[model samples]
Target: MATSTAAARREEARLAYDAFLEECPTGQLLARISDKWVGLIVSALGQAEDRSLRYSDLGRKIPGVSQKMLTQTLRSLERDGLVTRTVTPTVPVRVDYRLTDLGSSLGGLLSSVKLWAESHFDEVSAHRDTFDRATATS
Candidate 1:
């Protein structure tokens, strides 16, 4: 009876997890972080000891990012409350972005994901190449 109850509870948990995934898909998160520029920006910001970066400096730090795309990504991150934007009063307005507490928590998660990708990317590529070769031969 105890074993049966435990099994039923496990089945209920699995169903809840599946329902949650269906309700809130990972596609949006993937769209936010999968972009080369976004990942670079997030990683760079995450690395900063202060966890903050000037708008102009950030643009220079991440090479190959267009002004438009960076602006868009920053706006999206700010809207999501993952990053905070501050405008400083100066001769010319100075703007900065810093990761919020929530965003800081995600840094470790992103780092792990990055490490996994680096470690396994070559193996995955090799597997794809082998599959392609086999298909060609067949």
Candidate 2:
């Protein structure tokens, strides 16, 4: 009886965090996960040789990301239970990152989005150019 009540309560709490509501916790999560850096870093880690890469390797793989920004995004992903950070004691101390199971699930979705953007950029750009020209004259 007590176990059943606990399970019911857990399910209720889970149902409360709706992403559709502006003030919901899931909405906050959407904002975090939707960051450009988050998507890129996740995709990079997911596509690595063994789904892991050293910190420096990640920075190199991701162009236009400053060291500080890379560090910050990795920290954020770590905090959110998406990526795992491992430290190895070496001459220079190596740090490696990999996506967790939860992150791997998200990785597939983000990678698809990245690929779609790559696939459709020319068409999207043409639409954007038309919009800009039309809006400029009106």
Candidate 3:
């Protein structure tokens, strides 16, 4: 009976989250996951069969990411429990990163978002051009 009661309380706690509320932590979570770099990094890590890559490899795979930015992003993801960083002792230290189970679950969602952006780029660009022209005339 005590076990059942605890389980019920846990379920209730899980159900209490509401992203729409101003104080809800889920809003912060949404912001982190929706970030462009976060999405790209998650997708890149997800693509690897081992779901892991060295810091240099990640930097190479993701063009235009500054070393500082990549380091910051990886640290953030690690803090959020989405990725794990492993350091190997070698002649030169090696560091590798991999997505956590939670992060792996987000792969498909991020991939879909990437595909949508790519597929709709032209349409979005046309709209932006039209808007810019109208704003200029006004």
Candidate 4:
């Protein structure tokens, strides 16, 4: 009886996990886009006249991003079909980043978030300062 109960519990857990994955097939995709650098990169691409940028240009445009993180984020975005990477056959190997239709669809949502953050940043900062001071006093 004890063994059977344990097996049932394990099966239940497995089903739950599988269901979660099914519902959130792009959970990791969302996570990648939520990253600071990823958001910056996506926003930059969205704003670009051509809607694309060279890898080196992206690295320079986005402040405080390391080469490794940018590379990883770009690869993940490409794999998730949100971003497309194009390579030009050249001596130094030129590469560019562009958004897919899916990524473009996210542009308005991200822009709204950006607008909210910018508009309320001062208020949020003040609240944080007050909270910090109160916590320190307590």
Question: Backbone collision count in every prediction?
Answer: 0, 0, 0, 0
Candidate 1 lDDT, tens digit per residue, 8-126? Answer: 98986676556246554455665676777666777778987788999998999988888998999899888877789999999799998998887777666776777798899999999
Which candidate would rank higher by TM-score, 1 or 3? 3
Tens-digit per-residue lDDT, 15-91, candidate 3: 66677767778888999999878999999999987779999999999999999989999999999999999999996
Candidate 3 runs further than 4 Å off: 1-16
Candidates sorted by lDDT, best first? 2, 3, 4, 1
Clashing pairs in model 1? none
lDDT, candidate 4, 1-138, per-residue tens: 445688898986677556247565355566666888778877878888999999999999888999999999889878878799999999999999999998888766776677799999999999999999999999
Poorest stretch of ten by lDDT in candidate 4: 19-28
**Candidate with maximal lDDT:** 2
Quote each prediction's TM-score.
0.69, 0.88, 0.83, 0.77
What's model 3's TM-score? 0.83
**lDDT (C-alpha, whole model) for all candidates:** 0.80, 0.95, 0.91, 0.83
Model 1 superposed RMSD (Cα)? 5.5
Clashing residue pairs, candidate 4?
A: none
Score residue 136 of candidate 1 by CA lDDT. Answer: 100
Q: Which candidate is the best by TM-score?
A: 2
